[model samples]
Structures are given as C-alpha cells and as structure tokens.
Target: MTQTLTGSATVDEVMAALAALEDPKARAINESHGDDHGVNLGKLRAVAKQLKTQQELSRELWKTGDTAARLVALLICRPKAFESAELDAMLREARVPKVHDWFVNYVVRKSPHAEELRRGWFADPDPVVASAGWALTSERVTKNPEGLDLPGLLDTIEAEMKDAPDRLQWAMNNCLAQIGITHHELRARAIGIGERLEVLKDYPTPPNCTSPFAPIWITEIVRRQQEA
Candidate 1:
C-alpha cells in the first residue's frame, strides 16, 4: 500500500520529504505515485504570471544545494517564466543536469522563449547543454510549425553535426526523423541528413532495428523523399 501525501506541503517541504527517503527506487515511486507529485499546472501558471517578480527567487532556488529543490525550481522556471536577463542568469548558474529533460519538455518544446535558450546552449561548452540544445531544435521542428525559426535552427543543427558526440548525433537524427514525419518540407531534408548519417560508415547500429526510432525510419524518410 502507498502512503498518500497531502497536497498542502510547501515546495521546500516536499523536497525535504523526497530527500528523506534513502532508497532510490522508493523515492522515485513516491515522487511519481500520485497526483500530489504530478506537476501542478496551476502552480506553473502562477509562476508564469510572476516571471518578472520571482526571477531572483527562481535563480536562488535553482542554485540550491538540494537536487530536489533544483528540480522543482527548474519546473517552476519554465521558459515562460524567464525574461532575457533571467534566462541568461539561469544559463550561467544552473549546474544540475537532472533538469535537462524537464527543460526540454516544459521550456523548449512549446514556449516562445526557446530561441534564447537554444542560443545559450549552442554557445555553452558543456556537452549536456549542447545535447539539450540539439534535442530542443528537433522538438521545435516537430511540434511547432510557426514557432520554429527553420533556417536558423537547421543551420545550428548542421553546424553542430560536424562535432556532435555520437549520442547527440543519434538524438538529433531521431528528432529529424520525427520532424520529417510531421512536416512535409523537412522530409527531403531528413532524407539528406539520413544518407549523410549512413556515410559516417563508422556509426554503430542502434539496438532494436524495428523500433520507431531505428534506421527503418531513416530508410522510410529516404524512400519518401525519393517519391516526392
């Protein structure tokens, strides 16, 4: 049986509760086990509403020593919650990698501020930041038609491709394939990128060829491009 946490706990209190658990699996289970731990969309809205006012607190929260605190801070500091100054501060100060996925989902995917965040990541030396930037560009291509600055985004991807770590290349290709399926204009582009990937010749075959993200997707993209 799982224990129910009252939703009344403050964010700091919830972080403390999460930190108290010594077992990693148990902590994960507890954090995700109920609506209480679920992202509070209303809280997100409130944070978005206070973007200007809460900028400093958000940065401080992100810099906290506690991992859970930092995670929660990243959640609250969605792309919508950031202005130019705040975002620059976050790019410089936030050190935790655990929030990268959260940033991808909440801040970069559908937010208006993705461009600035992407620029920050592109300029950063950290592989994690670069990888996150590549993922964000892919996500923008797939999810947002008008939201994506296509030429600039594609240029960034192409530039990064030259020196992208193998993991980043794989992720970028996966995103490109997703964009190809969603956007007709990108289908030809995806095929070109896929063919270029194949020429790498040294690239390892990813496990599970039949998965949606496998080389099968690349082949399909190439076939569709030829058909067009």
Candidate 2:
C-alpha cells in the first residue's frame, strides 16, 4: 500500500520525519517531492498561510541549516498563496541557498508575476541568486521566447558562466536547449553552446550511464537548430 501524508501533520512533524533520514541528500530529494502525491494548489495555499502565523517556527527552521528543513520551507511557501512581493520577502529572509533555489525553481517559475520578481534580482550581489534569475528567465524563454528580455538574459548568462555552480550550469544548458527547440531563430546559438558543452573538461558524466539528460538535451537543441 502507498503511504499518505496527512495535512493535519504540523510542518515541524513532517520535518522531523525528513530529518530522521540518514542520507542528507536523500532527505533533500524526498522533501523536494512534496509537490508530488496529491499536493495541489488549494492544499499548498493553506499550508503557506499557516506558515505565515508561525514566524518563530520558520526562523528556527531557517537557522537549523538543514537542507531538508529548508526544502520544506520552500514547499510551504507556494506561489499561488503569496503575492510576488511576499515571496520575494520570504526568499530574502531565507538563509539557505538550496531553499532559495527550490523557491526559484518551483514557486517563481509558476508566478504570473515572474517578470516583476526577475527585476528584483538585478542588483543582488550574490552570484547564486543572480544565476538563479538567469536560470529562471531561461526557463521562461523556453515557454515563450518572444516574451523574454533576450539581451538581458544573454548578459546574465555571460556574466554567470564565469563561476557558476555545476547544477546552475546544467540548468542553463537545459534552458538554452529548450529555448532553441521552441524558437527557430536561436538555432545557431544553441548549436554553438552545445559544441562547447561537449568539449568542456568537467562536463558531468553520470556513472555507468551512456546517454544522460544533459548531452541528450543539448543534442536535441543542436539538431533542431540545424533543422530550422
């Protein structure tokens, strides 16, 4: 039988369950799956509102520095529950980078007010948040290239490439590939990036894997670019 998580469980209760896991990475992965199961907008909205009343709990969780707790915080702050300004405030107050990334990936990406949220990151001194903006913008572009601020995205990508994290770079490449697939005019750009990616000295190669998502995603981008 499949296990079911109860809505009545306090966030702390759920988090305790996550913390008991021996593997930190596995705990992070599992908490990120909060969106799975029967989780939907209504349930998430209720949880988010509940979090607003528990500021002390939220602060303690943030200070815990545990990846699983951070992930749970992000899960609780659903995009639909809070306005863009509110979410931005929450992200700013969040001390954990992984939690911030999760919010950027899941919450910010789903906001109808994404453009406004994107603007707030322009003066962010942190490379992680700045790169996250670029990554999120790239995702938006893939959905609707015409709506993107292309020059701004290009500048962000160029600036970020210098010292971006491996995961962020992977996300960048995936976003670029997706945009290339959706927008015929970006074919050349995608192919050039793909070629460079293939030759990168430390390009990720999953163990015992022949066709990882990264290379495959880039190849599709290159092929589509050629076709276009």
Candidate 3:
C-alpha cells in the first residue's frame, strides 16, 4: 500500500494510512460478523481521529476497503452524494448481514434516495435487499414515523415473515417489534405474530437482557422509552 498521506489526500492514500493501523484482535472480532475477508483497523473512533475530513473518500473505500475500512467508510460517506443506483450496487456487493446492516443504518437511511430505495428493495427478489428494506423501515418507525404505512407494514410481517430468508427474518421481526412498541393500534397484532413466530425465542441473550421476540422486545422498549 502507498504510504504517503496528507489532509487533502485521495481515498487511496487515506486507505493506506488506515491499513497501517490494523489490529489482529479487532480483525478477529470483525470476522465473527461472518465476512471471510473481514479486517479490523481498530476502533472507529480511532479511524475518525485520523481521517476526520475524508467523507468524500468513502465512495472509493466502499468499493475497495476491507471490512473495518468499509465500516469507517460508511461513517465518513456523504449520504447525499450517493445515488440510489450506487446504493443498490453496494447492497449487491455486501456479503454478510453485518455489512448489510451498516449500509442500511449508516448510508441508506441518510441518502436523498432513501424512500425510493426502500420501496424498490422491499419488492426485490434478493433477500438481502429485502431485509435492508425492512431494516430501514424499522429504523424509521423508531425515529420519525410520520408517513410510513403502519397497516401495510404489519400486513407484510403477517404474510411473509415466517418464510423470509435467514438474514431477512431478523429484520422482518424487528419491524414487528417496532410496530408493537410505537403503534398502540397494532400492538395486539404484533404480539400475536411474535407469539406465533417465536423468532429468536430459543436464542441466547446476555444476562438481564430481554428477548428480541416482538412481544417481549416491544414491551421492554416501550417501558424504557416511557421511563426516558
């Protein structure tokens, strides 16, 4: 990798600086996210310390960086600079759920084309894209849910959630939980679906942590939000 660096350096030059900060222990943690090519350059805070002004460089890094670098790239990327087509292409290149999640939370949600991309991806044949669509919707409901179609979203969870792809099921379930917590009108239906689907019911959680099954998850979040 090229070693030269400057505040105004191009993406390639900044990537080289990032590569020099790689940490094997951090890389191991990143690999557990399921990307065979995962690499960790240390904390995102540290990366930000170094490349604080390289938001525009993220486009190149998104295309070329390894896992850690890509995570940094997502943090630095200017959402408005990306087109829906570019976001779609990035989704196609994502190989694991973690990467997909970052793209959805960090890039897609902030993009000018967010609404269009969400609608298009919800209907996509690709499981990852569809999962991202649901994830984006869930985030919206949790934050600013002004215009979202709550009834239709619940209908989708009721209809197709059970058979969704492995990665997609989690996001679909998240939507269920979000609706239950945020939309008092749909809480009962959401609880019913959660009880029936039993998503992650048997899965382990950290001690004292509530289960992500919609009923329990929704109850916990609502209580927490109310307390806040």
Candidate 4:
C-alpha cells in the first residue's frame, strides 16, 4: 500500500486502492469510535503523497461518500483553499467522527475563516458541530489566549459540560484541561469544576496513557511541563 502510484489517479482508481488497503482489525477499532474507515493512515498518506494536492479529485472522491476515499481526499485537498461557506457545508456533512475531526483539524483550522467558523459553530444547536467549534476554541486556548475570557469559558463549562454529548464532552474536557494546564490562577478552579462534573472521569485508559479526565490530564501535563 506504500507503493507510489504513477501518473494522475482517477477517483475510481483511488477508491479501489483504498478498498484494497482495508484491514478488518483497524475497521473494528475505528467502528468503536464511530468511524467506518479500515484503511490505515500510513497507507492513506502514501496514496495522497502520490496523488499530490488534487482539489478537484478530492471533491470527486468526497462525493463518493466512502470513508477511506474521503480521508484520502482530506489528505490531498488544499486546506486553506476552501471558501468559508464550503468549509461550513463540509463540516455539517462530515458527520463521521474521524472525518469531522480531520476536516476541523486538518482543513478548517488552517483556513482563513477559522475564527469566523469557530464563532458561528460554538453555539450551534448541533452538539457535533459545536464540538468542532470547541475544538477550535481549545486550539486558541493553548496558543493564543490574549483576548479570550478565561473565566467566562469556565462558567460555560461549569454549566454545560456534565451532560454534553460524547464528542462535545470530549472537546469541552480538552478545553478545560488546557485552561488548567496553561493558567496558574485558574488551575485549582478548573480541577474543581472537573471534579464536580466528573466528565470522562471513569473512562478506561490504557497503562501509562493520560486519562481524558481533565483534573488528571491537566495535572499530568503540568507535571511534565515542570519536569521539562
């Protein structure tokens, strides 16, 4: 699957390539997370590498509505080239967790309209879409916190995070963790809020991997930063 494809590839050809790369084990794991794609990312990236950035081909593959093909399209598509409306349409249409996450992380985050979309989607009634908005907010929380209302964010999390849908809860938890890890003044209150809400507190985490529980995640990341 890592073999480089020569010449311009067609949508049918790329879809077939993706189908050929499917693995049952990977598909099972992805299915557990609400994604249907079985093609490993390495193989997908290899295919995208050969195809290069083909925006038209990416659009065609996306139209096919196949998970693997959509992922390849995401890889080969130019992130910043999309118009804001097009990105909004794609975000709403991309309901699959992996595809939604990729579109937000790989494409929308790089778009000139990231802030615009973030603002528009934050309070969108659709929790999944709102999750993408929160995801974007988390990025800004980590990288650029100057103008953001840190306490206001905490107030919202305190009110809404406990019963948020799975995806939205995860995104909100990430934002909470980031605030606690980044701001000394808010760390104790953030941890307290997390303790009260208990979102992801019981999630099963593998050995040595950080838990999604904000208190633990924030504390652990802060500890590591201190050591570094």
> Highest lDDT among the candidates is held by which one?
4
**Candidate 2: which pairs clash?**
none
Whole-model Cα lDDT per candidate? 0.54, 0.55, 0.77, 0.90
True lDDT of residue 174, candidate 2: 55
Write the number of the candidate with greater lDDT, choosing between 1 and 3. Answer: 3
Model 3, position 74, has a per-residue lDDT of 77
Give TM per candidate.
Answer: 0.57, 0.61, 0.85, 0.96
lDDT of candidate 2 over 121-217, digit per residue (tens):
6446655555566666666676656666664554544455435665456555555556555665665565455555452435566875433343355
Q: Residue 24's C-alpha lDDT in candidate 4?
A: 95
- Pairs that collide in candidate 3 are none
Displacement of residue 36 (Cα, Å) in model 1 is: 22
Error of 1 at 150 (Å): 5.5
Residue 76, candidate 4: Cα error in Å is 0.6
Cα TM-score of candidate 1: 0.57
Off by over 4 Å in 1: 1-12, 25-60, 76-79, 92-97, 108-112, 123-125, 145-163, 185-189, 195-214, 218-228
97 Cα displacement, candidate 2 (Å)? 5.7
Looking at candidate 4, what is the lDDT of residue 55? 90
Best by TM-score: 4
Candidate ranking under lDDT, highest first, comes to 4, 3, 2, 1
